[model samples]
Target chain A: SAVISQKPSRDICQRGTSLTIQCQVDSQVTMMFWYRQQPGQSLTLIATANQGSEATYESGFVIDKFPISRPNLTFSTLTVSNMSPEDSSIYLCSARVASGGRGIQYFGAGTRLSVL
Target chain B: AQRVTQPEKLLSVFKGAPVELKCNYSYSGSPELFWYVQYSRQRLQLLLRHISRESIKGFTADLNKGETSFHLKKPFAQEEDSAMYYCALSNSNSGYALNFGKGTSLLVTP
Candidate 1:
């Protein structure tokens, strides 16, 4: 199992501003993913960050709105640029590591952002 | 395109009653299926995966390929079992990224 730490468990941000959420893993991983969950909704994949390369975003998500940086195998950051009320949601960071004879993906506690 | 579907948005059962959360999927080929759960104050966590064929917290699921379903079931529901449940599918052929369902909110009342 992988231990992931995410900062700013909850925050209230004004619209038009940006916020960066950090994710740190206990060990190096091949894949790091960012997800978003709106209030009372399910999670949706935002992007995939692999160290030393550009992040691959899913359909409907763009790098301009959510830029990702993976400086190293164990650390990654997601910045929500030009926030809006629609961007108010729980952002989660997950990492995949080979463990217990299987590759498993574990998630962080998530950072809840309420954009006004 | 890969898609997951959770037919029910909400499922309620009394404590000690049986519970089942339905999940269906659409994929070109065989895919990995998993169940995830999230408590009110906790992060989303993996409950079990189809390949593992294991039961977690008395909950077990069987992947029926012909039926195209993986339903989560437990004989007795506990109040602690109340959580948001999601069904997900990941095909290694598709780069291991998961396609998740809309999710079902389970409420076990005492």
Candidate 2:
């Protein structure tokens, strides 16, 4: 399993302002994913970040609103553009690692975003 | 597509009692299942996976393919076991990310 670190652990921002969240993995991994956990809600996949290529956004999510960048195998960033109160949630990044002939996913601690 | 459903939002049990957290999933192809836990102020971590069939922290989950379910169970609940548990599923053939269910918050009292 890979260890992931995400920053800034938490933040408060005004509406219309954007925030970029960073996720770094201790080891190189092939696939990385971004997820959103709205308050009292289940975790939802936002996108899949592919190294050296544009990310694949999930349905109901758009590149214009939630842009993702995967500069390499171990690092990725997600930016929430034009923030709104509804966008406030805990954002997590996870990776799929090969273990015992299967893929196991591990997640970062998560970034708690609060929009006012 | 894969989807996981955890019916209980909260589950409470007294210490030394048996505990069970129900989970059901839907997927067209072979799927992998997992249980994840998040403790207060702690990061979400994997508790166990169906393939391994191993117990962690006295918790075990058996995959019932016929029922499309993987429910977590612990023989003797402890106060320290209280936490939020999420059931997740992923496709084995593709790189599709995990689909998680709404978590169940477990409370074990003395």
Question: Model 1: per-residue lDDT, tens digit, A1-116?
Answer: 88999998989999999999999999999889999999888889999898878999999999999999999999999999999999999999999887555566789999999999
User: Per-prediction DockQ, in order?
Assistant: 0.74, 0.86
- lDDT per residue as tens, model 2, A1-116: 79999999999999999999999999999899999999989899999896877898888999999999899899999999999999999999999888998878899999999999
Clashing pairs in 1: none
Q: Who wins the DockQ comparison?
A: 2
Per-candidate TM-score against the hidden true structure:
0.96, 0.97
Candidate 1 C-alpha lDDT tens digits along B8-86: 9999999999999999999879898989999999888999999899989999999999989999999999999999999
TM-scores of chain A across candidates: 0.96, 0.97
Residue range with the least summed lDDT across 10 consecutive positions in model 2 chain B = B90-99
**Runs in model 1 with CA error above 4 Å?**
A99-102
Worst 10 residues of 1 chain B by lDDT: B90-99
Error of 1 at A97 (Å): 2.0
